[model samples]
Target: MLPNQSFVWTGATPGVRYRFAILADAGNFLPDQCSTRWGSTDFGSRGLPGSPGFSGVPTRNNANGINVSWNDYNASYGVQHWRLYRSASAANRCSDTHIATLPRSTRSFLDSSAAFNTDYYYTFIASDLNGVNGPCSSNSAAGFRPGQAPTVSAISVSPATVVAAGTTVNLGVSATGAIPSNTVAYQWRAAGQVVGGSSPSYSFVGQGNHGTKQYDVLVSHPESAFSVTRSQNITVCRADQIVSNNACVCPGTLQEIGGQCACPPPLVRVDNQCLAPTPTPTATPLPNSFPQIINQPQSQSVQEGQSVTFGVVAAGNPVPNYQWFRDNLNPVGGNDPQYSFVAALSDNGARFKVRVSNSVGSVDSNEVILTVQSAPRPLRPVLECVMANNDGTLTAFFGYENQNIAAVTIPAGTNSGGDANLVNGGSILPGTQQPIDFSPGRVRGAFGVVFSAQGSAAYTLGYRGTGIVTETANSQSTPCAPIEPRLACVNPEGAGFRARFTYSNQNAFNVIIPSGPNNRFSPAPEYRDQPINFLAALGQSDHFEVVSSSGGDLTWILANLSATASGNSTPCSLPPVCNAGGPYRVQQGQNQVTLNASGSFDPEGLPLIYAWSTTCPGASIAGTLSPLATLNLVGNRQTCAVNLA
Candidate 1:
C-alpha cells in the first residue's frame, strides 16, 4: 500500500466522503462569487464486463469434478492476479471468499477436490498489481456437483434349485455407478444362524435328518445401507430315494451314498437306480464275403503344430479287424478305432487307407487325404475399461479375447520377458492385469500389446477431466462439506438466497444446469446470473467461509453482508422484507450510477417495486419507486443518501 497509490484505488470507501472545489478564486470566501459544489453519484450497469470462458468443451462432465480453463482478464488496467470463488448458492458476491489465488502466469485449474452429489459455484476475481480486488468477472458459474454413490443391482444365484445336499452354490452381484471405495460381503444363513460367510458363493451339505432346510444367501452393501437376500431349500434325500433323479428302489436293489440310493462303481446311475447292463451281442455264423467299408474316413485339414485323426467304419458278417495305412500304402500303428498323428508340414496332402479283415475275407478301404495350414499368430490385447480419478488422471484396464474357428482366450499382452508393451500412461508395468493411472489432463494416446499366441493390437484412447467450485446453504447453520478443499456455508448466511456461480473458460465451462436428472444441487441451492443467491430465510443466521477449490486466500468483510427476502409466487406466512438493489459496494466515479434490483426476488416470489430517497447536493433519484433507478450527482464532492422500503 504505497501512499496515494492510484492502482489500489479500485473504488471509493463506503460511507466515506470526499470534496473537491473548482473555485473562481483560490482564496475566495463564501460571501464572494466563488463556490464549490459536491454530490455523490452511483453509476455503472449491472453485470461485470466481459464473459469468462473455458478453453474447450468439457470432455468429462460427470459429477465427480470439472476441468476449467480460461484466458486472463484484460491487462490494460494493470491486472496482475486472479482469484476463484465458490459457494453453494450464488448470492454472496460481496462476501464470497475465493478458493484460489493464481498469478497471471496461468489461467487453468482442475477442480478435482469435489464431493459426490454436491453442487458448487465457481467465479473469478481480477486484481491490479497494487492489490485492488475487482468485481465478479460474470456471476459465479452455475452450481456443479461431484459424482454420486454407487447403485447396486442385478443380484442372482447360480444353480438356483437344489438337487443334492452337499452341493455348492454360487451367488453373484453386479452394480452400476460404482466407485472405488465400494465393498461387498456375502453371508450364508441356515436355521436362522450364520452358517457360512464371505466370498460370492456358499456351499453347504443338506441334512436329511432335518428334512428340507431353507438356506439364505445375503449380499450386503453396507456403505449405502443396502442389502439383498435370496433363499433356496435343500431337501434331505431318504435312504431309499434320491432327489437328484427321483429314484425309488427296494432294499438291496442299489447302493447308497450320502443317504441316497444309487448305482455301483463303473455304472451310470440315475433316479436312485443303476443303468441296466448292455445286452450281450449274439454271434451268428455267416457265409464268407469280401469286407466292405460302410463309412469312409474323411479328409483332414489341420494347421501346423496340430494333430489330426481319421477312422473307418465297416459292416461284416464275421465282424472286422482294421489296419490303417498312411499315403495309401505305408502301414501305421495298432488296429484301433481311429488313426491319429501330430501333423507336420511334410504331412500335408498325405492320403491314408484302412484295411478290414473278416473271418470270411478282407478288403482295402479308399484313401483319405490330409491337408495342412499355417498356425495363427498371437492376437492383440484390447482395452477393457477406464476410470477417472479425483487427482486428475485416468486408469486404463486392458485384456484380450481371441476369436478363431474355436473360441480361444488370449492374455492381455505378451510377457516375453516380464514387461508388457501397452502404453496406457499408467504406473503399473506391462504384463500386469492391474489398471494403470493416467495423469491429469486430456487423455489421448495409443497403446499396444503383442500376444505370443494371439495377434498384436494397438488402441487409441481419450478421457476428460472435471474441475469446479461450489457451496450449499442449510436452512440453518451447518458446517461446510468436502472438509479438505472448501469453505462451507453455515445455517446463518445465504441460507435461503438463490445463489448461482457462472463462468466460462477457453474450452467449455460447466452447464448452468446439467442435462440429466442426477447432476443436481438438490438441497435447494439456487443460481442467478451465476452468483449464488442467499435470500433472507426463516431461522437464518450469519455465516462465512475461508477455503479454496485447491488454493487461495480471502479476506471476508462480514459487516457488509445482508440477506433480503425473496422466494416463489406462493404467499408467505411471514411479512416480505424489501430488498434495495440487492446490497452494495460501489466505487466513486465521474458519471452517475444506476441501481439494479435484478438480484432481488420475493421469498414468496412476489413482484417487487422500489423506493429511493437521497439528500446529496445537486442530485436526484431517477425513479422514486422502481427496482431500477439512478442517483444523479450534480457536483464532484457530495454523497447521495439512499434508503428503501
Candidate 2:
C-alpha cells in the first residue's frame, strides 16, 4: 500500500469506505477471508451485513446498475480480454464470474447485449498482454459518462503577423478533450465564412481584407457535434502613415501647419506657430559706414622661394586693423595693410584669412588658398656618339651640371677601350657621351649603363647603332698662351690658409721663386691646380713653390726636385736675381725688388741691412734695410751680362 490507500466497498456506484477483517478468534485474527462495507454510511460500526450475501442485489440496466467503457471517459487504455460479475456486497465480498475473455487490444466492451431495464449488476475486468486488469484503480466512487466530443483548443498561425499583401500562412489546430481512437476532422473558416474542411491546418496564401482577418478551427468526432471553435486574428497594414495620421506636405507658397498647409510670410509662421508680418526689411541699423575689405593678391600659385602678398581695402566707421591667419587659426604676420610670405612646399593648401576689426565689430573675409609648388629641376643632357674617330674610338660628351661633378665611368663594351676593360674618371666633353675607344675587331658590341650622382641622381641608357666604323676626326685643343700672374690674395698669418690665384695673362709663365702655397720644389719643379694651366706648362723646366716669410719655413724641398730640364739657362726674371743684375734678366734694365720679411720677425729686433751683389765684380751695393728689404738694380753689359756680386 503506497501511503494514502483507501478501500471502498462499492456496488453499482454506491459511495462508501470499508476494510475487511477476521473475527476476533476466527483464523487467528487473519483478514484473508472476511469482508465488510465502509463509507458515508459509516459501515465500520455496522460490520459485515450477513454471513451469506444477498443474491444479485442489483442487475444491469436497472436504476441501481451502472455500465463501464473506456471510450466514454476519453480513456486511451486498450483491452484484450474482459470478465463480468455481480454480488450483493463490496470488492472483498463479491463472487467472481467469468464473462467474455478475448485476446489482443480492444476498445469497446458492450454490456447492452444483456439484461435491459433489469437490475443486473456488472463488474468489468479488462486486461492486455501485461495482465493489467481494468478497474485496477478506480475513484472513491464509480464514474460513468457519455462518449466525449473532440474539443478544439486555441488555433495558431505560422508567421503569425504579416503585411497587408499577406503571404502564405500555415494554420494549425489542436484539441485536448477528445475521444480516443476516434478520427477528428477539422473545418476552417475565415471571418464566419466557411472556407475549407477536413484538415487540421490550412494556409491563407493572401490577405483576405485590409482589416483584421480572423480564422477559426472546429474539431469533431463522427458520433458527436463539434465541441467548440478556436480562433486567431492577424491585422494587416499596421504601419503608421502620414496621410492617415496627421501629416501634410507644404505647397509652393504655403507652409505645413499642424499637418495642414497654411500661408507663411506676411503672416509668417515658424516652428508651427503663426505670427504677425515681419517688418519690411527695416533699414538695418547697421553702422553708418562699413569697413571695406580690399583684395590683396586675389588668386595665384607659386613655387618655393616665391613671394606672396596680401592686402585688403576696407571702409568702416573706424579704419579697421588687419590681421592675417594661416589655416584659419595660426596667426601670420600682420597689422598693416599688406602681408607677404616666401612660399614653401609645407605651405601648400594654406588658407589666408584677414580679420578686420573696428569699434563697431570685426569680420573675417572668406579664406583664400595659397598653392605652393616646387621649382622644376634641370634635366640631364642626352649624350650620343654621332660618329667614331679615325682611331675607331667613340668620343662623346654630356653637359650634366651641378654644384660639383663627382665620379664618371663608362661601362663595358661601351668603353672597353679595345682592351675589354673600363676606364673611369676621365675628361668629359660638352653635349656628348664620354669617349669610349675601341679597336674595330671585337664582337658583342652593345652598350650597357649604370651611374649615380649626388642629388636627384640618374643614369643614362645605352643604344646600339650601325656596327660599321667610319673615319672621324678627334677633338683638337687650342694652344693656350701663358697667363700673367696678379697678386691673387694675401693671408694674415693663419696655419692653413687659402688664396685664389688668378692668371689673366693668356700665355703661360713660370714663377722664378716661391710665390704662393708652394709645396716641394727642388730641381726646379712646378705645380698647376687647373687642367688648362697644367697642360700649358707641360714640358717646361720650371718649379713653383709657396715660401713662408719666416726663414726655413717654406713648404718645399729644393733637393727633392728632379726636373729633367734643369740647367737649361732659363732666366728667373720674377725675383732677386733680376733685381741684383744677375744672369736672370728680361731687358738688362734697372728694377726694384721688395722682400716682405714680416712673417720672419726676430724677437731681438736686430738692425738688418740689404746687401746686393752680382757675378760682375763692380755690381756691389749696400744699404740699411727695414724689417722688409728693397733693392734697386743696375744692368751689366759685359762679363757674360755683368754678373751681380
Candidate 3:
C-alpha cells in the first residue's frame, strides 16, 4: 500500500547543509544506515538568495547631491531591505562604506553627502528577512555633484572701440565651477537695465552719437545665492574717427598734422582735400607698314573624321583681313585668320595658304599640307592549302590576309576572343601553329598544323570589322600553287580602248619576273607601267593598261600563265578612293619610319580597311593593325615600294 505523509524538519541552521534518510521495512535503522540519502547538500541548501541582477547604474547630479538608480531586486527569497555602499575609488571595493539601508521596494537613492567636483562609486546588495546578505551587485555606478556658485574669471569686449555708428560691439563673460546639471545663468545689464538673456555674450549696437558705454555680465547658479559681476567699457566713435587711449582721434589714413587732416608726402592737397597723383599719358601710334607674316600655318596629319585648322598671324597698318585657298585655286575660307574643315580622302594631298591683306600690301603664307588617315579594318583568315604528309598524317597550311592598310593582330589560342585559332571538328587543335601578327595582303603558308589523316582542320579568325569567320580544310582540298596571272578587263578610253590586267600570287613571298620571255606583253614594248615585282596574294596587282586605237586585243604572259584582254571582255568597276600618305624620305641610317593612311575614307562613311605592302627587302613593318604603321628599315639605300589596299 502507498501512503502520502508529511514530515517537517524545523529550526534547521540557516545556510547550513543537511540530508534526510528513510527506512522502507527494517526492524530498526538509523538515518545513516539508509540506502539512499534524500536531502543531500548537492540538491541545494537553504540560503539567503542569489545575488540581484543590476539593470545598469545611472546617476544624476542635483543641487543637494547625486541620485543613483538601479533595477529592483526580485527573488524567491523574502527580501526585507537593500544595502547601498559608496566608495571614493572604484578599484578598492573593500574600502566601500555602508551608505544607506533602503526598504525592499526602493531601487534608487540620493547621496546628499556627495561633495561638489568629487567622484563617488556606488553599488547595491539585497538582504533577506533573516538578516543574511546576498552577493553584491555585479556593477558599480559613478556620480558627481557640482559646486554651488559659478565663478566668473574674466570679461571681454571685442572691438573695444566702435569705428562707425550702428557698429555692433560684443561683450562676453567666461566662468567655471558649474557642472552640466547646474543651470548657470548670465545677465547682461547696461545702465541698470537688462539688455540680453541667459547667454554668456551680449551684442551692443552703437547709434546716433559717439560716446563711452559700460556693459556688465552677472554669472550665477540657480541653486547658489552668490553671483559674480564683470564690467567692460566700449567707446563708440564717429565714422570719420577711431578710439585711441580711451578717446576718439582722426582715422589712420588721414593723420592730424598741424591740427588738420593731411595726406602723406607724394599726395598733394587739392581744394583743401588730399588727392591721388595723376596717371601717365599714353604714347603716340607709329606709322603703318606693309602686311608681314608673323606665324605661318603648320602642316598636320590627322584621321579622316577629325578636324584640321590652318591659321596665319600678320601685322599691318590696319588689322589685316585673311583669305584661304586650297591648291592655290579655289577660295575655301572666309575673312578670318584661321581656316578649319573636316578632313576627307580628297583633301589628303591638297595644300592650304592664307593671304593677309589690308589697306597696305598683302602677303601670302607658305603652303601647308594636311594628311588624313583611314580607319583600321578587320583581319580575315584564309586556308591556303592542305599538304599530305608521308607519315599518313595531313599537314594543313593556313594563312591570313589583312585587307587593311595596317597590320592586324590576332593572338593565338581559343581563349583569345576575336583572335586566330585552328580547330579540328569543334575543338581547338593541340600544338597548332598560327601567326599572332598578320601583315597585309595574301600571306600563304604563314602557319601549319599537323592532324590525323582522318581529321579535318577548321580555321577561325576575326577582328573589329570582320566579326568571325571559320574555314575548314582536309586532304581533299587543292594542293598549293604559287602564282597566276589574269586580265581583269578592257574599257573604252577617250577614242581608244584600254586593256587592264591583274594577277594573283598565293605564295607567302613576292614573285618577281622581269620583262623578258618569262614575262612579256605581245606585239610591242613589254614594259608599259607593268609591275616587275609581283606581290604575294590576290589583291597585289601589276595592273597595267595598254591603249589600242585600232581596236585590238592585248595578251600578257608570265612564265606558264597567260591572259588576254579584249574589248569584248567584262568592264572593270570604278576604283574606290584611297590615300597612301606619303612618298616619305628618311636618312640613310634611319632605323625606323612611320607610315599613315588616315586620309583615306569611304564616300558612304563606311569603315575602310588598311593593307600595307612594301618592296624594301629586309625591312619589317609593325603596328599593322592601326592606321599608323611603323616600318623598321634596314640601313640601306634601297628604294622601298609601299602599296596600300
- TM-scores of all predicted structures: 0.25, 0.20, 0.34
Model 3: runs farther than 4 Å from truth?
A: 1-286, 382-401, 406-448, 451-645
- The clash tally of candidate 3 reads 16
Every candidate's CA RMSD: 53.7, 29.2, 21.8
Stretches of candidate 2 off by over 4 Å are 1-301, 304-374, 384-396, 401-645
Error of 3 at 637 (Å): 59
Q: lDDT of each prediction vs. the true structure?
A: 0.48, 0.41, 0.69
Local error of candidate 2 at residue 54 (angstroms): 81
lDDT leaderboard ranking: 3, 1, 2
Error of 1 at 364 (Å): 93
Q: Candidate 2 residues 1-645, lDDT tens each?
A: 323467554441211223454322345665544344344434331122211111222223222224433222113333345444533234531244444554434433444333222233344444533444445222112222234465566777676444434456788877655543246777888888888878887876654344467777777765344456777875554222112222223424455545445655568755445568766665755455556675543656897789988777776776778888888888888697678878878887888878888877787887788888765332222221122222222222222222112222335335222222222332332222333432222212122121222111112322222121211112331222333332222232233222222233222332121222222232222323321222123222122323223222122222112111122212122222123322344345545544433233111222223433335434432442433444445564444332222
Best by TM-score: 3
Q: What does candidate 2 score on TM?
A: 0.20
Estimate candidate 1's alpha-carbon lDDT, on a 0 to 1 scale.
Answer: 0.48
> How accurate locally is residue 604 in candidate 3, as Cα lDDT from 0 to 100?
26
lDDT of 3: 0.69
